[model samples]
Target: MTETMDRNFIWDFIEDDLANNPGMKVHTRFPPEPNGYLHIGHCKALCVDFGTARKFGGVCNLRMDDTNPAKEDTEYVDAIMEDIHWLGFNWDDRFFYGSDYFEKDYELAVGLIKKGLAYVCELSAEQFRDPQYCGDLTHPAVSPWRDRPIAESLDLFERMKNGEFPEGKYTLRAKIDLASGNFCMRDPVIYRIKYVEHHRQGTKWCIFPMYDFAHPIQDALENITHSLCSLEYEIHRPLYNWVRDNVDLPGNPVGFPRQIEFARLNITYTVLSKRFLRGLVEGGVVDGWDDPRMPTLCGLRRRGYTASSILDFIGRTGVAKSDSLVDIRQLEACLRDELNATAPRRIAVQKPIKVIVDNYPADKTEYFEVSNNPQDSEAGTRKVAFTRELWIDEDDFAEVPPPKFFRMKPEGEVRLMGAYIVKCNEVIKNTDGSVKEIHCTADLETGNGMPADGRKIKGTIHWLSAAHCEDVTLHLYNNLTTLENPSAKPDDKDYTDFINPESKIVVEHAKVEPPLKDAKVGEQFQFVRTGYFCKDTKYPNTFNRIVTLKDSFK
Candidate 1:
């Protein structure tokens, strides 16, 4: 972590904590439950957790909160680690797992039971949440087993852990103030029984501690100085504090892990909930978890979003206490800003229109020197082949030109980007009245310099030599959800109703400059006048558009 003057409220609080406490270390942890692939929302938390720690020269642990075996898997665990690393954060030697401390957490549960601070309850899932019994924790609504004998409660807890009792038969709840306004403090369940196999722990323990109970203990055991989480857990702060105060932490430090909540990332046009995204995958609405249309970190990467761009987006979004929806354009703008300076330039014709130069020798092919990236001088230049036969964008040519149309038209002159000026002389039509070919004559002296007459050409269009171009596929992406707030629909309306039918458009026979034939997967380039694109990792000869050349959001 590099020391810097830039500070957010989180860092300000940490600075005060460090100033007050002499010789204490600044430490934070990114504890993500390995239940599903990480989404864009997690990226914000990741940056804050790791970025803060990095700024202050503190250690950040990457802990897996895999307390619930029912939904967790090693696959998600692997994906979570990959996503974190992909975002340019490393956990180093501080990687830990919540399930790894099951024995210690079990001991703490026993300590709570012996102290009469926790007990085994028999309330079913529904009955426990019944407003008649637990109305916001504002009044005393005791469970039937609240006053059970310590010995009996402990016995039941042991039996529950020993697999003698099936799941839901018994649960350990904290014996806190039942009249507290905060429901989280109202004797929250600390542990529950589950007979499922754990991803890491295997069948070692059938009884697992609940998230609220396990998270703090795991933090304390690992000496985590701060626990960063989203705003939804703000109310649970009281409970988090209660666990740290009640349990005899391993380190017994003068101070314990402090919990801070920040607004989670929300973007327009799509839902970020794991369940909704999983539904999209399962319902065949999306290709898979890594579908370019999805907001998963892996999906964004596959769609050509660089880690720096994502980090910049997070930085621009800033850390806020209040929740808000960020316009997706901000993210796209960050990506464009990054790619504009980094991606090399290339020429790709999405809709190929054949052009034949009558004055140029058909058998002669010449090369024109073109800069690979005008923004980057060190990127140098490459030679693009020019010949009598060329391919340009269909939209760039119109037989009956529209008003002010500067591209190729009957008898209209335009400059071939980095090549000679050409004048369209004839337009060949097919039986369907669509253009079949355009015959043009190029001024031999106009190339690599001004024309002899110093004529100004308003239109300069990219082109690829017909004999030297490579056939490629272009994938143009649009918003995945038609509705701006797809997840906010009425309960009766399905989220799938907002799925954008034209989200993914494929151009199968696009033509690109010959140099693109060697483009490796993940290599990015700006398709001059089209968009920024990356060679597809999943599909051969395909380039996924990162963003259009200009901002549409404005």
Candidate 2:
């Protein structure tokens, strides 16, 4: 790996490891089990794993450790690859599966058995039930087949390979200490007789290696140098190494793959656990894994988040020791910052209020050149139609002003942005007590005044020509869960219980400027004062408001 003068801490650690062992090559791999869709947490992990490899000028392998076939499927594998590719990481033709090492893992287990290091355990499903099956440091639970003869183990294991065992009839256990302080060191089941089909290997095998036994060996077999993972696997490291030491390498796969742990990302307001997310999908609380309100990478992409924003978010969150939940606002800020510099400015009206430009001639219409970006001058400009009628945000005007409100009020003068200065001559109301529309007269010259002059208004607001506006499907998103009370346990309650019903608000036939009708999918643009938005990838032609320049709600 090539190191620049400003090396990140991860590089420093890798450099030290390599400095100590010059013979070893630096390689890293992101081994996500393809059991469920990846979430924001996985996005962060991907950044660390792949970004570190890129900086060091090394290769990062995308290995799907699909060891547990029961919960895994081809759907997951496909989604995983799509997410990784979307995040802009190519695994360098080193894509792999732990099942690729099934034969080796089985052979190694048999070797361990032959060497008296493992045995076939006959802990009946009843005996392996409940707390009795759980392992702990002080008191390790014993299995019935702990004392089984090596020959019996070999025979059962061979039969297991030959598909002679029923699913729960026998489990191959590594004969480690029964009372080690580390619960994993206690005699753990290395392989289980699972008669299930695998996504990649198909119906070729019945017995599968357990994750703990399969993962490290696959890394060693691939000659992987650094196996960076979330902190949860820190405890699993001991067993990770124990399997490496016991199983003699095939072709002497390089020094046992080193395991490093960093805190995993925990995004607040939405559940990140695969189990909980599964419940959300299966229970119909969410439309699916890719629901724009969900935090899956696909969901983020569909919700109009840029890959660079995600990567920047991950890098900024960085590695931590004690894990804490991050506010979703922080993520939105990254997008807002990214979009502000990239997206063009356009006017859209959600809950639109109609305004009649009483002074403009009915047949008159004109174009005012508006800059695409307010922050950058070189971003240039686009023309917008200023007709006799215009639409502004419904909330922009009030019949009786709320004191400090600057937008629009009875007799208030606010510039209809880029068009003309206008005064609210009247607030038209319905008998039902809702403001139907506002009547205004434009200052022809205070547009600087053939109609009026130097008219100072309290506020300048966005407007789209009523005659020239295009219909758009707009989606406004909010946090899925709504407990502003931060101390509320996101884990204790069913995630669905906390779900904000207003999370995904869809607006049909929302009016927008004529320019955005041809706006392509994933093209970001500022909707005037309405915050940052992009064409949703799922809808492509539809717009999704991401976040605003200011945290107005906060």
Candidate 3:
């Protein structure tokens, strides 16, 4: 809610409303359906709802749109609340569920029937959508039951609620224009019979109100001043207003709530559809909803993403009236920026090779002082143990040097980061013709200082005391989908076919500095020359790579 020079269109509308109606409070609501975990896509609407309230010094309510109990559960509700709190927003005492207003919803539907604005239709779902009923551009839809008596329709609706008829047997449809250009107004179904048990209301109700009908009623009943939603709902705005104008709710003292639609968030190389993400979890394509490779908020949290960084990314993306695909690298850059300035530095050798300092005493062990975070002055320093035997990353050495390779080579000198300068004298190979150990001689005079011989060492590599380090597991992650826009793939091919097989790479045994042994879950650190990583919350001694050190975003 920080004041920015460039105000988005939503803010402009709110400002105009306030100007026209003085003393009116700005109120909003975030109604997320509790069927699956929230992903980055939801975060945009979330910020717009809560952030607008904060800016206007008003109130924002959190509501669960759990009208459809087919897949609703209390577990997803709890996770939704947790995710909102993690983003540093709260609903205070203004929390509600769509099912809580079931009695009112039923009364309003009955009121519509009595006023001849609604009627009970006995057409099957498929039959209702057939060419005869669902008219094309040239002809209007025709329903035989459209002229049914109001009294007869009321009787049928009551019976439908009483569970006398099975689901899809009858639906209460609003008597709107059948030839309306917008199909949402073409006698939309206001209520349907669903025999499923509600997560909260239990078996008290057999028939539930559809979202299109229930959402406006809930907003009006809760006195929501503005109902901000995604762009897809823009076409349904007329119906939203119709429900508000017809319903006579005592709580709706502010007249009709304004409906505003904004563009949805779409990022390349990632899928944000809750249904698709659910498939990934249920089909065992991924570990679970919180898999580090998934785009769910919990997954990003496990991947070492901070709430501030996410908010920053959302802020940078800004509010738009039209949808556009943003590069995923922009999100990664925000995370990398925050982590670079906050995460402490640590040494980890994923592929380790033994380095034996021949000139140094076999039993000798020295300490080197290194900065925990060079970017932060108050971060201070930590002591790293330097022993005669050490473990260095295998990539830092080459027996037969490649072109422009400045790292440890035969008879070449390189500095051990924060330690002494060492020269590789010989390479020891195992019976299988692979590097087993490296023999080197250290310049004792260059301990924690440059050599007096005026020699410039172009290569510097991080090392860990072989005896003082701990073995841990490391997980490196890439894009979940190989294609930039998996959703736009050929219609014949499924989105799952584009799943990146190499999205997650695991290293069973990696050496880490002693300080990392006490690192708590959720704590992030920079792995020196490697990448940023965080301790896995669900696994022991496991770290997930957040992002590489190099920034690929401009």
lDDT of 2: 0.80
RMSD of each: 2.0, 2.8, 1.4
Clashes of 2: 9
By lDDT rank, best first, the candidates go 3, 1, 2
Model 3, span 25-62: residue lDDT tens: 99999999999998998988889999999898989999
Give me the displacement of residue 73 in model 3, in angstroms: 0.3
Tens digits of per-residue lDDT, candidate 2, 1-554, equal 12211345566778888788766667889888898999888887787787777876778898888888888888999999999888788986899887888888887888999999999988876776545765554557777678889999899889988887778888888888877787777788888877778888888888888888988888888888888888888898889888888888855334458888887787777667788788888989878898888889988887788888888777667666567777777788888887888888888888888888788888988989889897888999888888888888888887777878888777878877877888889877789988777888877775523333333566878888889988888888888877644346667776567779899889888888876888787788888778777787677448987776566322
TM-score of each: 0.95, 0.93, 0.98
The candidate scoring highest on TM-score is: 3
* Winner on lDDT (2 vs 3): 3
| Residue 101 shift from truth in candidate 2, angstroms | 1.0
List the global CA lDDT of all models: 0.88, 0.80, 0.91
Candidate 1 overall lDDT versus native:
0.88
